[model samples]
Target: MEYYEGSFDSIVGDLVAGNRVPAVISDEEYGWIISISYPYKSESGELLGYVCADISMDSVVRDRQNYLLSTLLILAGVTAVFAVLYYVLFNYVFVRPIKRMSGAAAEFVSGGRDGEFSSSIATLSVRSRDELRLLCDSLKRMELNIREYVNNLREVTAEKERIGAELDVARHIQSSMLPCIFPAFPERREFDIYATMTPAKEVGGDFYDFFMVDERHLAIVMADVSGKGVPAALFMVIGKTLIKDHTTPGRDLGEVFGEVNRLLCESNSEGLFITAFEGVLDLGTGEFRFVNAGHEMPFIGRKNTFRAEKIRPGFVLAGMEEMRYRAGVLQLNEGDKLFEYTDGVTEATDAGNGLYGMERLERVLCAHGADTPQEICEAVKRDIDAFVKDAPQFDDITMLCLEFRQKTPGIKEEEQ
Candidate 1:
């Protein structure tokens, strides 16, 4: 091997010493370099040796470039696929719900009724168990709840209207039961009487009536039932009728009250009772006999002064089966006035939770004693309203007033 190497070097040096051009030639088998001399020379201007370097990069450079190109193409394709999938998912799950929700919100804002919100975006099954799905579910449920609430509100409002209508009818019927026409008998100049009732609610249990017992006496009655509404109204009717039936020109006031009390107790079912004041006025003598049944004291106005008359009150009717009553008498001179009322007046409460007590009522009566019966009643109502000052009325207020007049025999003859 050493001799061969030396021989090859000597030959290459002789060729390159001749100033030859070196050429590298390669083939599939192996690679080598050849040197060719331009002019033949031996000692002068000759190359020492041919210089050559040969290397093969067939596996390293070519294979690496091809591998890199293939990797880049695979990565681009994968990225494209991922981007397409993301686009599809975003449109189906996110974009679709957002669009539907926006449209629904717009419709709701444009005067849509409660039923319009029933439609939901939960039908899209793309991302069924994710946050977006839960959001959609919640929205659907909220819409359902809102719809149900609105329906309930409407039903409540309708029920309230129905109750209000029934109450109105009840009020009309109750008012008809009383004497609404004023000046009941305008031509009977022997006396002037008037009464009024203002109920806190649509219907009340306060009532008043006046009727002539033959030609010599006048009957007046005022009552307040224990309860309110239809039951109390019915009781008031029974009480008034019973009292009127027993009242006659010569009938004793105490006997009339006792009989009425016994009759009420016999038929009373809910333990209802009444506080009543009944009176009979002799048209000729101006003498009044009255009975109080657990009622308020009466006020008499004479010579421009009003004072509460102390009268003994018997037991409330319809509560006891064997109750007794007594009568009290008062002689009313001509031009004398009498006032009677229910406890609703004195018990009226103000905004400050203060009662319009007996003292205030007396003051009101004295202040408006000279006015007509209607005017006096109005004055009392105004004072109550002023005192209450936006507070709710809790009971029925009623009032009755009477003026006595002696019939002149000569004038009656003249009229006849």
Candidate 2:
């Protein structure tokens, strides 16, 4: 074979420029070749010849492609194995436990009042020694606490409902004890009487009564007991019964109160007392005899003008034993009215802590001049409500109004 010469200009130029670069070229003889060159220099670093080498790139390219293919295949196999292992480990360590906890929580919430939630949460198990286990344990304790709290809440709610029901019944019973019917003395036309009581609570201590002791004498009572609610209401019942029982047409007013006071003092175990006012109006003579026991002053309306009656109040009933009370007498003419009330009217509070005082009461009474007893009471209540807008009533309010129209002539007294 004839020898052939090949040009290596690119490789020689790179060697001269102090670059150690290899060159690839296509050749008729070698098909594909890579030429590399290194300079053989003198000790003084002068220009010198180059030592060159040519490598067949076809085999090298094929070998490199084979090596890359093998590497990629090995990498793909390793990655597939790693992915499978990861899926198994992750499912067992994290996903499975998490799913179990989620299922148990769902069941607990949906279990309802049959109490299966406790068992569902308590039986949950997490095998991992990580935050999952800690969370499972915490969930169990929380479930127990929540269940106990719910049970206690149910008991308390039931107890409150029972108490509310009892109080409702007590309110109705107490209301029935008073004279709720209107036209109290419909048979007699000598006087027109109207009275009302508004309790601060379900039951109150304030009470009023009007009944005929005889055909000639009409007895009226207005009283307030100490305290409020059940205890005071019970005391009110006793006091009202005692007052009515002792009042008679022939008995002296002072003597009647004296006996009632002694009886109340004997059974006053609760330290409760009453401020009471009782009056007997003789319809024939227009004579009014009344006793004041630590009670508010009565208003006398004469000639269309009202004035507070000045009477010295005696000690409250049940305050002490052997307390002597005095009686006051008033001559009632035709068209005269007597208005009586408890301290609740004068002491009614407003949102601003101001009192609906005696001044306001007297003003309200005077404003409703010559009005009927019913109209007068309604006027006063309306005025009080206006003055005490949105404020809670702090005491029991009671009122009684009796208008003496005329003396009944030729009316025979009924035998007692």
Candidate 3:
């Protein structure tokens, strides 16, 4: 009973004092042990020795540890059961639908271009009201729109190709309509004649023609219709045909244009008009009789060097009914060249928004004077090209050049 020192002493003191010890006390030798000791009393007021009971703290801690381990095992089993249930629920509720949408998307992308669209998404869409359903709706709308656009695009492309083919044939026909042959007057070489025309489009509105009306009169025509493309080309053909038809021997150049204008106005329903300049050069006397109907001034020279010939222009052809044209006479001496062109020459624009004005044309036309009519036309073309480098052609460019070699006695030029 007295094995423990201080704790036993306190119990004994309590018993001797006749007081009750209520608290557990610890001892070093017992590790984690506690004891309760109290005083014992006899019935005759006699004092008895101390009686105490002890319990070890080690057992309490062991019981606590065992309880904690059991609690943890129960919690672990519950947690495992709930984890399996949640996995199944999540896969059934969300993952399965998502996978279906994903598979549909992949299939549509792989075969969509062939005009095949998937209808499987609708099933999932009707089954749910979540974001997945909205995604399916959006995909359907997108593919439908794309399909419509693709169909429309195919139709437009085919139509464009057809129009392009027709225009090509038209361009060939238009080129053939004019006297595109280099040696325009091959056999009779009273003077050398060469002309060129370049349309801004595949088919242009500008046209040039040189043909002998008789043994003495060589008629040259340079005209520009009001517009471009098929309509302008049609009008150009009509105007060209009328001018050539009305132009016969013993007819005044101005009167010929007046008759042609009347014929064009008869069918000018589109209100389209033409600016024309035509001249008849007398091979015998070297006298050129020309008429200008609101056309650009001609450049007069033998070679590349030239000057603008001033003229009082009449109203444009088909502008009004029964408008009279005025004729002008200019003598083309031997070795003298007459260059005629449309507005496309002086009115050319550059990339800098600069007009290739008449000043530039004169300067370029006067430089590097060549001997032949063909060389004169080509030199001016090259100069215009160089001046307007990389700039798009805005209008039809047409040029005609003729050199008078002699009067009554025609001089032969080397075939060029």
Candidate 4:
């Protein structure tokens, strides 16, 4: 208190300017202080020494800081509570329902238990009236449609299987109708004959037959119908029966075909026709008489080679009424063979759509000309297969071979 000496420039300046100013001051003991300074003047307001008052500010500042901290903590607590509430509400409304739907879809697609398909999505109950509920309903409807489709598919599959079984039986029956037994005339040693028929489909339109008309006459038939499959097979049966029944011992082949053509025209309601050739060989003299109706020419094997024998073809059987036919004769010497076939051998195709034409057929036939009748037929088939190479068969292939060795001993020689 005695001789207080400290720098008071700001206080002095305020006092000289005759102002009362409050200011912040620092002290070692009080830490922080506020002061107000003023001039102590005479009663008439003359210049005089100054007087000042100081106050500590620590308690006021501390109280204000505590209030702000309390306010911030309360706000943080309120924000956290709102956030928790929002999460629960959102999960119940959207996330939980979505998770349930996903699980149901997975179960259904994974092939649940026998009765679980209908119940998998149908039992998902979404309480909210939103797009998710609509989606659930859609899933249920889809499941129902799938079930109906499966039932219909099963029925269709069963029907298809039944049809396939019937077709298989039909194939076997058609095969049995042909002369499948080799060495057909086993007891006779005067000649050897062999033939084969392979259908492009389950059944074929081509057929061949050989039967002894009498002790001296051997009749052979080779024919191809206009179409294929069941209808063609039925027509083939009719034509075969008609021709065989009309052919009798010593009956001229031309007259037999003429009569058979009339009979076929009367019954040809399906507008079908046949390309046929029939030949009668006399075992005593080797006189071969044949008639052709819109069919391929026969290949004659002689001198260890094969050549196509040219013949004028008449109209196809069942083409029209009163179509005349004529018989062509050939003298078959000893060791000569007759090879007959359908157009299938020539028209066979490859993946490149190339035809296995007559040139190729003749080459193959001549290559195996010296072999037995059965071996010759098999060789031709193998060559055709090699040329076609995995291509689908589109037509029926049929072939017949007849080798007239010599007349039977003790048989009367017929004059040719």
The candidate that wins on TM-score is 3
RMSD of 2: 6.8
Off by over 4 Å in 4: 1-141, 413-416
Query: What tens digits encode model 2's per-residue C-alpha lDDT throughout 1-416?
Result: 12223555534556667655545454655676766566677789775777767778788778989999999999999999999999999999989988888887788888845654546888998887899999999989988897888788888999989987888898898888889898887888899999999999988999999999988899999999999988999999999999999997689889989999999999989999999999999899888999999999999999878899998999999999999999999999999999999999999999999999988898888888699999999999999899999999999989999999988878655521
| Runs of candidate 3 exceeding 4 Å displacement | 1-126, 302-304, 410-416
What's the lDDT for residue 363 in model 3?
Answer: 77
- In terms of TM-score, which candidate is stronger, 1 or 4? 4
Cα lDDT of all candidates, in order? 0.78, 0.88, 0.83, 0.86
Model 4 per-residue lDDT at 330: 92
As a whole number from 0 to 100, the lDDT of residue 178 in candidate 4 is: 83
Whole-structure CA lDDT of model 2: 0.88
> What lDDT is reached at residue 67 by model 4?
88
Consecutive 10-residue window with the lowest summed lDDT within model 3: 407-416
Off by over 4 Å in 2: 1-123, 126-163, 411-416
Give the better candidate number (3 or 4) by lDDT.
Answer: 4
- Cα lDDT of model 1 overall? 0.78
TM-score of 4: 0.74
Model 1 residue 416 distance off true place after TM-score fit, in angstroms: 22
